[model samples]
Target: MSDAERQRRIAEAAYHKARERGFQGDRHLDDWLEAERELDRQEPRRP
Candidate 1:
């Protein structure tokens, strides 16, 4: 799968996991998701 698609799945899983654990604050999730994307971008791609 493409990087973007992988990121989307990761974000979705994070969201559901947070919800299951009773996490509050929309900003918290957003910040985590944004950080994940940034990290992904910074990582070197495999051949």
Candidate 2:
């Protein structure tokens, strides 16, 4: 997928993660990074 699409997916994943935790403390960055790692593992970038 394109960079924009990838970013959108990550953002959506992060949002869901945050929502899952009741949108508690300031963990946006952690959620985003976790999303990125999950996505990357699912589909690694091309060389």
Number of the top candidate by lDDT? 2
Q: Model 1: which ten-residue window has the lowest total lDDT?
A: 38-47
**RMSD in Å for model 2:** 0.5
Candidate 2 — worst ten consecutive residues by lDDT sum?
38-47
Residue 33, candidate 1: alpha-carbon lDDT: 76
Cα deviation at 7, candidate 1, in Å, is 0.1
Superposition error at 26 for model 2 (Å): 0.4
Which parts of model 2 have CA positions greater than 4 angstroms off? none
Clashing pairs in 1: none
RMSD of each: 4.4, 0.5
Q: Candidate 2 on 4-24: residue-level lDDT in tens?
A: 999999999999999999999
Please give the TM-score that candidate 2 achieves against the real structure.
Answer: 0.96
Q: Relative to the unseen true structure, what is the C-alpha lDDT of residue 31 in candidate 1, on a scale of 0 to 100?
A: 54
Residues 15-34, candidate 1: write the lDDT tens digits. 76577658866666675676
Model 2 / residue 40 / CA error / Å: 0.1
